[model samples]
Target: MGCDGGTIPKRHELVKGPKKVEKVDKNAELAAKWKYCALSQEKLRRPIVACELGRLYNKDAVIEYLLDKSAERPNVEVVAHIRGMKDVKVLNLTDNPAWEGERRNAKGDCYEDMHCAMFICPVVGLEMNGKHKFCYLQTCGCVFSDRALREVKTEICHKCGDPFQDEDIVVLNGSKEELEKLQKTMEERRAKAKTGKKSKKSKGVETVSKPSEAKVSSESKPGLTNGESGGDSSSSDSVPGPSSSSKTAKPITAAGSKRSIQQMEEKSEAYKSLFTSHSSAKRTKDQLSNWVTHTPYHF
Candidate 1:
């Protein structure tokens, strides 16, 4: 379709035979998919004109096409085009490390969920002859670009020098300083990584070391000690009664034979005399001699 006062030939007019029919089918399928997706999402709305170019194109191919076709094309405009353009909740283009020019940037670690729905912050774009040929912008899941706002006009792409006009293009942008900073930061992180300084600390972790055990009470308790070095006083206190070996002992009796209380008393006296030591006997005898007269007839 011709626009901007140019007597341009129709898309089919440029093709011949099966090529023309193939282009028509591709365009028709793209249009149908775009419309269907739009109707399904009521609140988010849809682009007035949606196309399915990405279906037949990979990201690298799409980028190369934009750069080549738009090069040498006069008045070229760069528009924002989304990949996987189904009910897109967020633009996951940032997840592509190849486009970001750095591995860290590709991770998309700093972005929020809504960040994807916002402007194409990373600005995926076509770099041509050391200068950016196009830029893409997005807001509220709506993709746009500087070229899209401009009047439609054919322009030669800066790189390939091909005749082209820009509409609904996806261009990413990043300044040299921003890229350099990102690169330096990534390097710094890499250096730190080599040292193995980073650690994964959990929520309750205050300091990483063996935790001290709870203190033992002054009063003895099972399975604990009171800090004394006497082989653990708890050991002697809890020792079970003598093992089975000590349980086989004979019983003791008050007398040699079953006797009256007087006989038992005489036996006890004899046993005491036999068991008493000579020193104790001498002491008892001296005390008895002092307390009693030599005539012991009174006894």
Candidate 2:
């Protein structure tokens, strides 16, 4: 065949192949989870905090988000459940001894350690680089590897020596299954707390009701006794004959009657002296004649 205007096809160009699948780097993924804040995606610094779901965050970043949740943020969905500071616990991380933070970044230092860790497990000496499972105590905030805690098997904290229960231990950056289990446990604890409050309230109501009931019964008994005694006295007094009743009724009417003016004057000598009905001293006949003349005309 005659040669065409197009260039010759190479062996590699003629071969058809499937698109390559992009794979995430293990080291980079681990670094993102452990050394960076889950919410802000910044380098982890002091005053780091963790949520109940084991997501890590910077304390300042969380505070800023809480202050103005309506503000635009890069990863707002990551902290949608975080309402306030109570949802997060500040970590008390142990600094790694091998870390040379500022000195390693010096201009003169030729060799830099890429695998340096900022914090480590105090008991197992494991770097917190997402390779091993880690957990923190809610009571003390001390962190340790899961393996170390299982091996040691003590109720007291390895670093602070404070006593702790299984309920107090919270996993950091746990898997989905672990997070679900933690949520269930939290719900159960809250339910128990509510039940306890209800029981106390019921007990208080019972105590108050009992005293009031006793007072009502005691007061009712005295009223009944007084009523019975008064009724008995009234019945006994009513048993008299009609003649005796008439005689008693006549005296009651006489005692309650109003006195006449003549009877009142006869009862008291002081009242009789106020009027001239029985006066020993009388006006003279000449004084009466003068009183009649003085009334008609003045001299």
Candidate 3:
């Protein structure tokens, strides 16, 4: 055993170390994020859209997802947050003049550039290949780089000249932290809209009930007057009230019954006895005399 081949092992060789993390190609990652649709994994084309969280997608891909949500898709998680078309904004892109299209290498004659972009920023002339930060206006759908907006600070859009506020700016392809912030802002806006609708409904109900309450009060006024005046017809008739025709009720038999004139405080008792209903108006046959029928001149 006298050290024939140095059989003693080092601690570094005996124990295994953690594996090194693999690095993703930066250029390929950028190409995937900017050039390909998040939902369908297809090449980005005209009428591209960006969601509220700033994830880019093809317009056709989003529509397909909404049409058949039960169908299987490659990237279902990417579109899980999008509920409808309103959650996304169609991008307004500016074409790059120098870059040729897919047929640029039709003859296979020259070098192909993978970094070249189809669109560029209208204000700063920067190619939108994920190297420069870009944002779109929510009001006009115009795209511009962050540098252009920072250098030329104004409320008006540089591309469309339309007026917009700070809240209307939405960044394209934002980071995770930025997306979380955007998600919170969206939820707050929806909550506020719901509260506003509820308040309007309550106001409408109050307005409808006011007329009904006024109608009930008007009908009750005539009843109180009739009770206080001992059913006097003249006094009850003088008070103005709503017409009885509007109510869905038939006239009661008691409504036609009139109080005897003797009960009326306004008329004299002597005048009340002249009515046929009074006891003085009746006479017995034995007590009847014919003196009033004879005229002295005619006799």
Q: List candidate 3 stretches off by more than 4 Å.
A: 1-17, 107-109, 226-299
Higher lDDT: candidate 1 or 3? 3
In model 1, the worst 10-residue window by lDDT is 247-256
Highest-scoring model, lDDT: 3
In angstroms, what RMSD does candidate 3 have relative to the true structure? 17.4
* Residue-level lDDT tens digits of model 2 in 1-299: 42368768776677888889999998888889898999899999989998877888999999999999889999898898787887678888899989987677779758766567899999889998888899998878888999999999999999989999999889988888998998888678768978999999999999999999998875554344324657654764678778755643554455456665446745677765566653534677765664344364565
Instruction: Estimate the Cα RMSD of every predicted model relative to the unseen true structure.
Output: 29.0, 16.9, 17.4
Q: Estimate each model's TM-score.
A: 0.18, 0.64, 0.68
Q: What local distance difference test score does each model get?
A: 0.35, 0.82, 0.83
For residues 73-100, write the lDDT of model 1, one tens digit per residue.
3222222333233412232222223333
Backbone clashes per model, in order?
A: 19, 0, 0
Q: Residue 9 in candidate 1 has what lDDT?
A: 73
Decide which is better by lDDT, 2 or 3: 3
